[model samples]
Target: MNSEEEFFDAETGLESDDSCEVSFKDATQENGVWERRKKLPAEMISRNNFSVWNILKKCIGMELSKIAMPVVFNEPLSFLQRISEYMEHTHLIHKACSLSDSIDRMQVVAAFAVSAVASQWERTGKPFNPLLGETYELTREDEGYRLISEQVSHHPPISAFHAESLKKEFEFHGSIYPKLKFWGKSVEAEPKGTMTLELLKHKEAYTWTNPMCCVHNIILGKLWIEQYGTVEIVNHRTGDKCVLNFKPCGMFGKELHKVEGHIQDKSKKKRRVMYGKWTECMYSVDPKVYEAYKKSEKKSGGESKKLRQERSCEAEEADEMPEVQETVTVIPGSALLWRITSRPAHSAQMYNFTSFAITLNELEPGMERLLSPTDCRLRPDIRAMESGDIDLASSEKERLEEKQRAARRERSKDEEEWSTRWFQMGTNPHTGAEDWLYTGGYFDRNFTDCPNIY
Candidate 1:
């Protein structure tokens, strides 16, 4: 099938059932990979050129910000929803929580944190700025996890999110404040914030901060993004921490996506070393005592040929396929050496997104009853964009924006301040900053008025 068929199925519509899940692989099947399509419109390309040239002339030695860019350079999702991108590898987190070793859990958490930056690999298109009080929630029944995010502030643009996994006894909450800068040729977004994760079973709490985001090749070449800086994950309970340094791309294309870090004990003694590419997999390896471990399987070579018929009869009795074969390799060794699976390469890119990028803003299948009236899922314009109706999306976006402006004007007349429904204000002990905490009893507290079985 072609690209059009890969994105939409004529029989089942956009929402594919299990039988007809849309695959974005090339039809020829020679190379099973995701086919890249043109991401920008011709008009937008020309508009970007003009905008870049004008900005370069005006800001000769100054840094630029979001105010310098045109709205056309934006994706259809809101920034508040973008925070959910961290959940793409929830399977890893679940597996980690199930493990018994603390070091094993730390490795998995490190992998999850590093892999979260992979979503920014392609072009750096801005997501829409969420209006004040806009909310989004994600519920994964199979994973036994739920997450809720809200936009708390509009002027300085703050967002907060909370996620919990009751089965794993894991809970996390955090806030993000993206500080954007424009340097004529590229833009930098520093997501300054702190996240706290709790393992209730272990009574352990971990905190970490994000790295700096840089978008390059915006002026004269193909645009792409890179994240540079250090990510430090610290266990407040045990004083163990992991520090990862994301190396920036060099000038002549050297070591573009390389990252190396080490896990340290309370006294800063190195324990396990990590090395990998952000776009690929991260591995924990200790080179000081490096040894390869491989498992072997043995089959009886003296078995009689007549016994094959008997085995087939037994297989038939068990409803097993005679032609199919199963091979299990169990390699039991040190748990430090393992790879974190990156996003699937064959997965389709909607508007030049990584495979897991769109999953962040995905609406739960039956969450309509649990959503508030101001939820992002109810926004008609964004929904239009999701369905590939660009014209309708643009019109609806303009209409909604104008309506928002009118509402703001009315609020100004009444001297009213926008208030969030689910989140309450609290102080962050680490930073002493007023933070928004989720008080909606989203996970444990009863929702007596909720019509949905959430």
Candidate 2:
């Protein structure tokens, strides 16, 4: 059978009444307990005057963290706050913990991993590089989780975060040191770190690293982002593993935003095949059905080759490549695992932020009194930027950076080492790699030893 006939068969199967039902509490609901702003105080300004190529031409092949950037390219949030967005899909973790079957639990865990990156769909603005000794804390009693993030390193720019359920059912923590490089028309970021999730009730621990992300058309056309690499998630206690491959966009753009992988048991037997687009949703199907579809697709390869050749010819005649369809075509008998939460209506005017990201920098009434002085909420530059004062934000950013430099010089002159208040350098027990671990005590609210970096 041809590929078109196979697709028709799949569509017919999708209409069957026996499709599986996916259930979970909505992650976007706040339950009237806490209120968050739906939009930023000011809309994003135009970037026509600024030229990224002019600033980045000389810095190609170097780490972008070392280069000083203007506030015009920033999104009024710190990198620490950006990291906290991982918790937006906290319900997935809760769902994983509730499942009894190991394979079912592994499926939910894989869904959680993909959902973590969905927030980056249209987020192109850079987050403010966190200052040394800077910190961010988020307490969401509504969601039953509280997160604390801290900047532990300055030279290499490492951000460490730890989140735990209020009921102590699970813990999620990781330390990321992103190495960003400019390659003429694109900037690629290698997220170097291991993320671990511990389900205390099940005594199961899962560890995985994020895939590499790249922003294309930096010097020419519309800026687009893609994540492409292999992410291997391992369950230390059960020996189950999920291997996911984020496919790069091909010449024909047929594989854009595609992710495919399989789950294997301890004996290396493939149990389930998963396929979907990261931007929209993820689904899992039986290995038998997945194999059958691949065979049919291979049999129709002749037509695909002809189409690719035609597209290549058209590309040489046009200034831009043809637009690819953005939706995922799921196979029949696949169970839905996850879907992205929709953004707010005003998201486009607010740096393309999601509903959760719009509230990351909000300072509620009397909230400042309860926070540490070194918190990112108190950073003058970010505050100014969020309020639409571009001039003040730019000047404040320069002043704070100079102050940090002066402090570093003083410490060097006095032969002193910078001390991190919330986290310490340690080794990850599961991965056996050097990492920054959370040292419990940020919630105690005692700020005596915290540095005054702001």
Best by lDDT: 2
The list of candidate 1 runs beyond 4 A from truth reads 1-71, 287-349, 359-369, 429-434, 442-454
Each model's TM-score, in the order given? 0.72, 0.90
Model 2 Cα lDDT, one tens digit per residue, 1-454: 1101110011101121212211111223354433456677899866778999889999889889899887898889999999998887787798888899988889889988887887887788889999999999976655567789999999999999999987788999999999999988788999899899998899999999988998877777677788889999999999999999998777766666788999999999999998888888889989999999889888987456777655541232222333556677778889988877777777888988877788788776566677888889899999899888999999999999999999999999999999999999999888888989999987777888989898
Residue pairs whose backbone atoms clash in candidate 1: 64-182
Residue 352 CA displacement from its true place in model 2, Å: 0.9
Candidate 1 residues 1-454, lDDT tens each?
1111121111212332223222221122224432323221111212333456554556544544334344456666777667877765666666666778776677777877886676666646678777667777765443456678877876677888988874658887888878777676667888977887777787777778888887765565556677789999987777888899987765323445667788888888777767676765667765343233311122335436665444451221222212222221222322433333333454334555544454444443444455555667677766666666666767777776667667778889999987666777798654466767778555432344432101
lDDT values, one for every candidate: 0.61, 0.82
Minimal lDDT window, size 10, model 1 = 1-10
Q: Go through the candidates in order and give the clash count of each.
A: 1, 0
